[model samples]
Target chain A: MTEPAEPHAHQHESLPVAARVRRLEERVIAAGLTTDAEIDELLTRFYADAAPVNGARIVARAWTDEEYRDRLLADGSAAAAELGFGPQTSGFQLRAVANTPGRHNVIVCTLCSCYPLSLLGPSPSWYRSLAYRSQAVREPRAVLAGFGLDLPATTRIDVWDSTSEIRYLVVPVRPAGTDGLRPDELAALVTRNGLIGTAAV
Target chain B: MKFPPGSRVRARTTDPGHHTRLPRYLRGHTGEVVAVATPEPLPDDVARGVPEPRVEPVYAVRFHGADLWGCETGGHRHG
Candidate 1:
């Protein structure tokens, strides 16, 4: 067998992240640690259970219930647990930031991609990209504009950096004309980008 | 928590050349404590695998963009 490439060369491999993950899974399965079916089952359950919809559910409840909104604002993990979304197993505390008529909120991890994955599922590739991580904090308005979110000039923007063991979830303002909608319908309107603070609900 | 909410505090300046949760850009900069997170083991120690790591409160500090990058707008929340 040919010797493996050096670390520098290996880092430059053109394989996509999914391909690399599949290769790792193959190695693990070959070593008798786990079966491919078992891994697939786990992934299926994870995607089904822990997704952006979970966050949408929470936001829907908050929009309909003022008390619940207060609780979510005060203690996000506890409020999420009330709705069957378990606290993050990573021990990262979840903090919810609400957007208002005068202010908007956005989240980024300038150091690394530390997101509230249990609530928002996998982060978008741009969330972890160096360009975003650096620019989100430096030129937030420009970045938001790129996402098609152009807030009024008077609206203040709060950019949150996931620098510690605290993960943040942006609670976008409930859309107008949705007062007659049911909770589930409201939840359906909440998008992953809205929860990430890159877009409006 | 050592610093209560709304209190202005400066991130301590240090470059120990080790793993730490505190971002480098925040060092030597002052910000207001917006919230206090539950006490947890110091990440610097946790990364180093120190036995019996010391626990401490993690404050969510809000640094204005003008102070952080000399920009004329925005507020940055850093924990």
Candidate 2:
């Protein structure tokens, strides 16, 4: 008779939490602990329900109303509550930092991606890319340039380094010549770079 | 307490982390929160080990073109 296989003996090695988790997951898969289909199904359901809709609406509203826009810049949470959004997920806090003609703003996550999910919605794929993550802090001007955002020689660009505790989003000035457009229409003009303060309205 | 709308608030500079909406340039400086925008759910990865249902509201803040560029000329300055 073959000797009984040791149960999870291979997982006892001393490793970092992240590495350990990855290794254990591999073993579990080898042992058929859970089906891939089940995992995928759970993820699908989780994300489907978890997408940030309320934040998207707030961003949309800001595009339309000048008064509301002013309020959001002052107190992000209160203004969000006024719009009927809140009471979920670590309680919300809103902070708005503006980008001006002479000074530009850029945001980044040094440790990981922490974004303003409420206002800008989910971070774009580029935000998660290593190129963006690394370059954002090292040479922000170059990174912004890659995005086609050009600032005057006299303008100074300020880079905000994001850590594990805080996430930043840029509030680009409302584009010029969009005075009469509807909110939804205006939102369309708000690009990812604009929200990050790399691009102007 | 109720605060007037469009009042500028300075974010505390002590806190540091991944998802801060407050920019470094504005930490000590003050700016008005332009709008009370929308609420957003916290990212699951960050929300872990802290509290359940982490969500934050989004605000639109405006800093004067002058305030940010006061050191340089030709930029808008606060009156």
Candidate 3:
């Protein structure tokens, strides 16, 4: 594991762009300048004012409608358009990936938390923690175990570590006996961790 | 040209500039591109302290759970 450098010593102008950025981020996290609740408050305000809620509605509708789910998986942006999302500004394509018993899914941002806020709402602090990001790629089993997600030895562990160019979100499989649930009810089951593949409904 | 929506692509090693969205863990990892977001101007507030409009397209990708964390030696199945 790379030891975190002394924050004060790494100047943005001296280091490579990536390293500089990383060091700055590390400093912020190390300083504990932003509390989790404050971050959540920011996200809450951002989503409340932005189009994320609309995206979540689209996801919930798809959860209840199989045809919509097929369409969403086929053409995410188009399906999102059907629900009055992504028409002009804040252009984001929404895709929904189902996590079944056989195949599980998890998401991580190796860079920063480039989450799909449009559909999943705010990201949790753990999702942005250096511990989670670093450990996620190196020792996924141990990390998931910490999350109480113990997979069988046979299951292939595919980790999607995000880069600046791309982001990711997991569409946890709807819990059993939720076949007849409404969109609003299904939304309640979609926890933030569930969207990242750490927990399930 | 706009690639087909949901088309999966790997990041080229030569892409320039600051890339904060990509995680260090998945630098060379592979996954399916889930969606493409609208192009937005890069914010100057990035840790790099550079303020330039980005030309790269943003995407959402999916990775399998088992692919991330290895299967346990002798634990019960978890999804």
Candidate 4:
């Protein structure tokens, strides 16, 4: 007996976008513009090692080290390099915005999904969607609420629209009660959403 | 930096028929220069295929939500 059709199975492979991308890569390679190894090396260097955990490690270090926190707030790119995840790979400047009492920071690219990929991994699809790109700047409080984060009215929300080459990283306030936790332990508590300012740590 | 950190400036409203780093929503809106960003090649020139695009410092501007949306809402900083 034949199995029923599963339209969504292998959807990503069968998608038009994937086909177009493959075609483009094939054409470029056929033209001798680039080799497969070159493309794979570029991807491996830029994307393979990228993850939200990299950002968490930075936040964890900041929570544990006062001087490092100051350095991060002063110059984010340099501070990130100190932790081995620098903007050199991304070719974009990194800026860390820390959350404090009565103030919160969120990042959105109104033009496109400009994110610190070297530190935060790939940008979330929602972040790249038009709804999020527009609504995030217009109604951040409501957007944050939809993300299950309801900030008090008194809390000022500062949405950073990354229209330029500079990418933002939100340093969420260290959660209460975890004082004795080590950097690795604190890093475990740091979520991707926390790094994105969608959720707090 | 062309504008100091606290200098108030308005994003030019002139809509050039070419690529630009400034977004439409922020066009013609006034904001405070919060910081000086790295100097970048002018996008308009680069888009026009200028071999040598002029690089200039970009300012980080902070706009109040009340001003951008004409309501007492949240604020944003553009860079």
* Most lDDT-accurate candidate: 1
| lDDT ranking of the models | 1, 4, 3, 2
DockQ of each: 0.74, 0.06, 0.17, 0.70
Q: State the TM-score of the second chain for every model.
A: 0.92, 0.56, 0.54, 0.87
Candidate 3: where are CA atoms >4 Å away? A1-45, A49-56, A87-91, A163-166, B1-79
* Candidate 2, position A168, lDDT: 53
In terms of docking quality, model 1 is medium
Q: Give the runs in model 1 whose Cα sits over 4 Å from its true position.
A: A1-31, A87-90
Model 2 C-alpha lDDT per residue in residues B1-79, reported as the tens digit of each score:
1224477765557556554444454556565664443545544334454556556544444454346545422221110
**Top model number, DockQ:** 1
How many clashing residue pairs appear in each of the predictions shown?
0, 45, 19, 0
Residues A77-101, candidate 4: write the lDDT tens digits: 8899998875543587788899987
- Model 4 chain B: lowest-lDDT 10 consecutive positions: B67-76
lDDT tens readout by residue for model 1, A33-84: 9998999899888777678988899999999999999999998878888887
The regions of model 2 sitting more than 4 angstroms off are A1-42, A49-56, A87-92, A117-122, B1-79
Docking quality (DockQ) of candidate 3: 0.17
**Which of 1 and 4 is the better model by DockQ?**
1
Judged by whole-model lDDT over C-alpha atoms, candidate 4 comes out at 0.84
Which residue pairs of candidate 1 clash?
none
Residue-wise lDDT of candidate 3 within A97-152, one digit each (tens)?
56667666677665556566655666566676667766666666677777888777
Which is better, 1 or 2, measured by TM-score? 1
